[model samples]
Target: MSSSTPADAGSKPAGPLSGILVVSIDQAVAGPLCAMRLADAGARVIKIEAEDGDRARDYDKAMGSTSAAFGWLNRGKESVVLNLKDPGDLALVKAMLARADVFVQNLAPGASDRLGLGAAQLTKEFPRLVVVDIMGYGRETSYASKRAYDMLVQSESGICAVTGTPEVPSKVGISIADIGTGTNAYAAVLEALFERERTGRGQALEVAMFDCMAEWMSLPLLHFDYMGVETARFGLSHASVYPYRPYHCADGDIVVSIQSTAEWVRFCTTVLRSPEFAKDPRFIDNWARVQNRDALDEAIHAVFTPHSCAEMIERLEAGQIAWARVSTLHDLSVHPALRRIPVEMPGGEMAEMPRPAGRIVASGAKVPPLGADTARIRAEFAGAAPAAAKQA
Candidate 1:
């Protein structure tokens, strides 16, 4: 594992966003994750937290003394503690925003407005600043003020209805709502930055968690709205696609997907060793197979249940079928394709974790401790601070 201190003002990694400055009043998963992406792209991210720090910091001490969530989402950024209710501290934030290229926050709905750090207010004051407001629901809706945690938003968006087994609706095991919202926020920030380059003016943007989950639920929503098809929860199996789910083998399970006629033919002939099955009238096409899924499952189980995972895998490879083992956490920990990067935790210990897709993060980037850069930042912006409560 590699290691480095939290980046100082004078030093930043070389990337497309090398010269960009990001000031974020962010907490928890969504906001921090968005800021981290900017930091990964070499933007200098200054994370302004409350005096007690981000609540995620106390979620768990899974990574030494730092919470796993905080450690995972806060590398390569400076941490500054501030009480927004304090006039002096609020002035400091305003000073930082004056020079920042982007500002991101995921405070409770209307909290930013109370603090005078709302997107509308910020963009008006800083014409060149791209401002992003991450919210649980769109401000235009009645649910705007409703509290929305990851599971709440997932349930509200009907993601739970199409997940889990047939008997039980379940929220995703991971925080998909928060993750998707943060990712969308990051993309919006990037778009705003590009637009700023073209127009020499930045824009205010809103990214709602409910909106993100709704977009992800498009397939199920469309089916129900247009075709009167309520997507069923199939557990490990797909609701609409036949033979696109896992089958129990001698030792474990392996998922197989036959998406086209050619793949179906190859699967029947090579993997199942039954070319005749490919021409069966009840399973000739995808729609037909879906209708006769019970018989299809029985037939597939008859073959797979008698074979070992390795044997089926070899046959699957021979047939060029898309397949995967139902991998556990242990399996993924040792996965050959999993790429890891070294990160320096808040306590100065080096740890390795999976790398982000499509981004080259600096290996030695460090996660800042609570208020690690507070004093320095306070001093740097002291002289520039406007009159207390004037703009705030």
Candidate 2:
């Protein structure tokens, strides 16, 4: 709501969060992606980095100039370098936040306190500032001091237990715990902004990767608690859902799901051409089918394994069964649902990145070069009061 460069005033920001100024002190996935979502929705995000910049910038250098992760997360942000330990540099950031509607940070626990940028302190000092803290674990717990990474959170939250085959536990391939925490932070910021509009005040919010992942594991937790049913880790198969996994084809596998008895009936009678299998006592209902999945799958393999991909797909279409072909990265590169836009690399060359999820369609400007806007920003705010009216 402050006029200190939420976006350049003449031309407008595109989405609901337009003109929302965000000052982010962050590095790595959870923190950067949280701010990235805000930037995607038209917030003017100032990404503060150390003198070396975000380490992710050099993470394999796969995006022609910058790391693909850095290119994706830091797009459309104004990069500014600062050392919070230095009084002058710290003052500069304070001025930036003075004008910012939101402040996000993912410093190791207690690091914010060491820098005097703690959420409790910031929100108290500037009541209209929405402060979001991303952590590995809840601050109130003993694990608060423990270092957290995506894999660690996944393991701790029991996600690893349910993710892979029970004999060999494995973490998710993607940084899901980090993404979950980041998305939660993003949603929390929106909720806080809505409340700020009503109350004319802002609040501090926290989302830990561990806590967020635990919440995501709630259904399995409930099952484990009430029925003592620890989920089995069947590759590509849901622990509870029957016939909701890949069936062997000649070349590979085609995933299928049957959520209802009628769908199961269709799958058995139409797809497998075995009408009696649907009425078999051992595979009558979802639970029974789940219990007898190994036998049913063996029978299914006999029917499906002989078919080519084309024949399997044709049968699937005719059967009206819900199914999908697993797409590799090659397939995904040109998929119909994938949307991408050109982003200017550190150099003038352009690289494409995926658009933001959901319907808030926007293509942001070039990702800023490391500290590219630093001198201009410093010159503007040099003699500024703590209130940040210098920008105005």
Candidate 3:
């Protein structure tokens, strides 16, 4: 990887996000994740950052001094650090926006509006541009003005309420709130793009982190609404489904989900070595297993006790049952499906990071280096020269 070439170096061919120009002013996860998805699909995304750059750029240099978050989400895009407060810088960004097909931003509440870069303003100026506004909360909610972080939204959305051990609630370790909002925003932008193709006009999208995660919490809310009781944190167990959780094996833990009665019959016959057990009155069906939960759990434990994790996996495979290994973070780093790419940094350092999971068949696709296209962009946008970079 060289400074003038692939910032995060990879040999993969161009992807589907190719050709489309996406201009984004973003910090942290949500907006970046969305843009990254577009980039993965072969979009020519330009990430316009503050002069200091996205805070995520410095969020822990885990991958040999390169921020893991940045290395992950920022690949396949050009990074242009500009001070939006400066008139020249603002003009430069607006110039880019004027030619952009999609504009995304995740600034503080009312921040874009105050700067006259709100969706309304942008839509008026660029009627064909799809403007996506990513916020932490719904624009008119009670917590609209309140600050929201990833974990905070997860907690407020009742995800924490139903996660972790019963004694204490815990937020999901990952940024579920931010990621979910970004995913929804991406889908909305795609839908808006499709609509624009027919109407020849763009649409404004408002995606809130709290709302996205809250929508995921709907099932638990519905349970409480109809049953007058909230779902409890049972750790690895399904809140409403019995025998659908991890069980102890001799050397390690294995998770198994017997979702259907037919599969449960196979499990009893092959894994449990007790075909008649499936016909027992106490464990005849899903509801019976739930009603005789204690007995059912004990029976499952007995069947699983003598086997090791690998042995249990084999049994589950033989029985054609769905199973999982309780893997650790360390284990995932070397997971067979993991893909890594090298990114060129300022100090002549190259950092290898995971590639975004958007595999498309194309050629000559790559991530641009920081300011690599600055002079060309200036010349092209200032109307002093022809486009210095290839269009699409």
Indicate the worst ten consecutive residues by lDDT in candidate 2. 4-13
| lDDT agreement with native, every candidate | 0.88, 0.85, 0.77
Query: Candidates sorted by lDDT, descending order?
Result: 1, 2, 3
Candidate RMSDs in Å, in order, are 3.7, 2.2, 4.8
True-vs-predicted CA distance for residue 125, candidate 2, Å: 0.4
Clashing residue pairs, candidate 1? none
Clashes of 1: 0
Residue 244 lDDT (model 1): 96
Off by over 4 Å in 3: 1-17, 339-355, 358-372, 383-392
The 10-residue segment of model 1 with minimum total lDDT is: 1-10
Cα RMSD of predicted structure 3: 4.8
Sorted by TM-score, highest first, which candidate order results?
Answer: 1, 2, 3
True lDDT of residue 219, candidate 3: 86
Cα distance off (Å), candidate 2, residue 312: 2.1
> lDDT value for candidate 3?
0.77
TM-score for predicted model 3 compared with the true structure = 0.87
- Give residue 258's error in model 1 in angstroms: 1.3
Q: How would you encode candidate 2's per-residue C-alpha lDDT over 1-392 as one tens digit per residue?
A: 87656323334356677779899988889999999888878788888899999988998778777888788777778888888899999988888777789999998889998898998888877888999999999999989999998999999999999998858999999899988999999999999999999998889998899989999999889999999998878878988998898888899889988999989888888889999999999899999989999998899999999998778778778888889888999999999988887777786668877776685445436777889888877876676675524323
In model 3, which range of ten residues has the least summed lDDT?
Answer: 383-392
Q: Model 1's lDDT to the true fold?
A: 0.88
